[model samples]
Target: MATIQFRLRSKANKNVSIKVRLSIDRNNVFELNTGFSINPKDWSETNNLPKQTTPENKLLSSDLKKLDSYIIENLNTDLGKSILIDSNWLESKINDCFSRVVKTDTSLLINHIQHIIDNANTRKVKNKIGLSASTIKNYTLFRNIISEYQKKIKKQIQFIEITKPFVDKFTNWLINTKNYSTNYAGKQLEILKTVCIDAEKNEIQVAPYSKIIQHFRESEKDRYIQTLSFEELELILNVDLSNIEQLNQFKKENPELTKNLSITPESLNNVRNWILLGCEIGQRGGDLLEITRENIRYNGKNYYIDLIQQKTNKSVTIGIIAPHVIDIVENNLPKKIPHQKLNEYAKVICKLAGIVEVVKGTKLNTETNRKELGNYPKYELIASHCFRRSFASNYYKKIPTPILINITGHSKESLFLTYINKREDKDANADLFMQFYEKLNKDKEPQLKIIKSGTND
Candidate 1:
C-alpha cells in the first residue's frame, strides 16, 4: 500500500514531497518511485478537449481530472524555503481540486468543505481566527443550499457551472426556499464567490467564476434600527451596584466575609464609573483601558484629553469636562487591575444590574420582550457598544459643533451621522421654534403696550 507523508528536510523549499513508491520485489526494491509531472500536457486528456459542452465550452470530466494532476504537481514544487509539505499549501491544493469542478460539479464544493473540516479535526491549522473556520461554516451553509436544490429538482446536478438562469433560481431559492432575507442571501452569495475564486485560479484559461452570481446579490448597508429610550438609558445609568461590588471587594479584603457575603463599595463605584465614562466618551473599551493620567493635558485656561484613537489611527483631542466626569476621573478610577480580571468583573457589574439582551427579530420581540427590553437591556445584557452609542447620543443633545467633535474625538460628519437619531433632530428643531416664538412675542409686547394705553383712554 502506498502512503503519503510530508518531507520537510529544508527550511526554504516549498516542494511538498508527493512520493510515489512501488516495490516490485519484497526486499524493498523500489522499481518505480516518482513525483508529479510539472508539465500540464502530461496530464491533459486529448479525448476530452474537442467535444466542448454547453455555453461555457467546458472541458469534459476527463479533462478536468487531468487538470487536477497539474495543480497537484505545482503544489508539490520546491519553490519556497523548505522541502516540507506545508499544511496550508495542501489546503490550497485541495481548494484547487474543487476549482476545477466548480463549474462542473457543485457537489465537489461540498467535498472541499468536508476536507476543510477534516483538516481541522486533523489539527492541520487549528486556529479559530484563521480564514478556514469562517469559510468552512459558510460553505457548510452553502452545501445545505445545494442539497435542497437537488431535492427540489429531484435529480442530482452533474455540473457546478451556474448559468444566468441558475443565478435567477439561486436568488429565488435564497429568498423563498431558504427563507433568507436579501442581506443574508447576499452573504451566502459572497461565500460562493470566494469558493469560486479559489477554483477559477486553477483553470488553464481562468474565467471570472464570480460573474455567475454577482447579479443576484444586494448591496449591504448598515440598517441598524435598534436604540434605547431615555427612560431606559437613565435606568441603566442608575443600576444598583451597591451590594455587588461590596461582595467583590470583601472577597479580597475579608475572604471570611466572602464565605457569608462580601462585595465592596469601591468595586461597585469602579463598575459605575467605568460604565459612565464609556457613555461619556463614546470610546471603545480597548481605547478606554489605555486612557491614563498622561492623556490629560492643560494649555493655560483649558483642560484637554488627547490620544490616538486605536481603532482609527486618527488623532483625537477633547476639551470641556463636566464636574461629574471630573469627579469620576479623580476619585472613582481604581489602580489598574489585570485586563483579564477587569473584563470578568465588568460582567459581574452587568449581571448585578440585571441587564439582558433581547435579540433582534420575531423570537426576541415576542418571547424575550418582557425580560430583555426596557432597563434590563442596558445594565447587564448590553455589550460595550451601548456606552459609545449612548455617549454619542447624549452629547448631541447638550453640545454643538466643535464641542461635540472635541469631546468624542470624531472629525467626520459622516461618522457622527451614524450616531445621530430622529429624536436629536426633533429636539433641536423644537427648541429652535420655542426660542423663535419667545423672541417674536417679546418684540411685539412693547408695541402692544402703547396701543393698550391709547385704547384705555
Candidate 2:
C-alpha cells in the first residue's frame, strides 16, 4: 500500500514549485519537485492541493491525480520491489510518468547502428567519403546480430549497460553460440565498440568499460592460408577445351560435374583464360573482373594492365611479361563473368585439372552458415581471391619485393609477406653475393702475387 500527494513547501505570493511526496510504509518515504508551479493563492491549504474552483486549478488537479494513479500502479508491479525508495529514484519515476527524458526505441543500441547505416553515405573515413559497400554490409549484419541477441536475452540493450560483463557475454554468444570464427567475432566486437565510441561523440552516455572491451582474434599463423601453386595453375592452363564435341561427351559422362561447373564448352575456354590472366596479374576479384580491353596499354616494349584499384583508389600498372600471357592478352582477353560464377568455375577447373590433394583449410558450410575448418580437397577451397594469393606466393623472391608490392598494390612489405605467408629467402641473392666476392678476390690475387715477389727479390 502507498500514498502520493502534491504540496507547496513555502506559502508565498509569487508562484511556487509543486513537490510530490510518496510514502510506501511507516519507515519508507520519498519526495521530489514535480516541476509544476502555481501561486499559493491558487492552492488550497485546507485540502493540501490546488482548489478546483478555477479551470486552470481543475486541469492541474486532474494531472496530479493521474500522476498519483501512475505511481501507485507502478508500485504494485514486480519491478517495484527492486527499486530503491529515494528522492533521485522518485524524480526518475516522476519524469518517466510525465514522459520526460526516458529511453525511446530509437535510443537503444540496435537503433544506434541503424542511425549509422542511414547516415553512412554522409560519413567519411580516411581520404574516402562515406563507408564502403562492404563496411555497410558488415554493419548491417552486426545490427541484425545485435537485434537477435536482444530478442534472445529479452532485454533492450542500453548504451549505459554496455559494460565489461555485457561485452564478455556478447562475445561468448557471438563465438560459441553463433558459431562465428574468432576473427569474425572479433570484427563484430570491433563494430560494437565503434558504434559505442561513435555514440559518445553524439553526447550519449556509454559505460566506461566499452572502450576497453577486447576484440579477440586468432593469429595469422593459426589461420589457414590458402593459395594455388604455380604447377596447379599450369595444369589448369593446359586442360584442353579445344573441341566442343569432346566437352559435350565429357559432360554427358559426368552430368553432376558439368552441372556444378555450370560449364558450356565456349565458356570453359573463357573462364580458363580469365583464371590465367587473374593469376598472372595479382589483383582482387572485383578489380580483376572489371578489367576491360581498354585497360590494356602497350608502352613500346611491354603491354601493361593499368587501372586504379577500387579498394585503395590508387593507380597501378602490372606488366604482362610472360610471353603466353602477353599473347593471350593481345589476341584474346576472356569475356567477363559474374564474380560468384567465376569462383564456382575456378573450383571446377582446378578439380578437373587434378588439384584434389587434401589440405587443411576453411570452407563455408551452407547448413551451418559458417566457414568450418577441416581437411578438404585443394580445389574445394579455391575462390577468385586464390588467383591473387597464388600470384603473390609464386612470384615471391623471384621478382624484386618492391616491384611485387607495387603490382599487388600492397601498402606495406610486412602486409604483403603475411598475404603470401613467406619469409625473405635470399638463397639466390646469397649465391650472387658469393660470386661478386669471389671476383673481387680474383682481381686482387695477381696484384698480391706481384707485390710478394717484388718484396722477396
**Residue-wise C-alpha lDDT for candidate 1, range 258-341, written one tens digit per residue:** 333225666556656666666666676667767778877767766666777654444777663656567666666545545444
Query: Per-residue CA lDDT of candidate 2, range 354-379, in tens?
Result: 88999998999988999988999998
Stretches of candidate 1 exceeding 4 Å from the true structure: 1-263, 337-377, 401-411, 419-457
User: Which pairs in model 2 have colliding backbones?
Assistant: none
Top lDDT model: 2
Report lDDT (Cα) of residue 102, candidate 1. Answer: 29
Tell me the whole-model lDDT of each prediction, alpha carbons only.
Answer: 0.51, 0.83
TM-score of each: 0.43, 0.71
Best-fitting candidate, scored by TM-score: 2
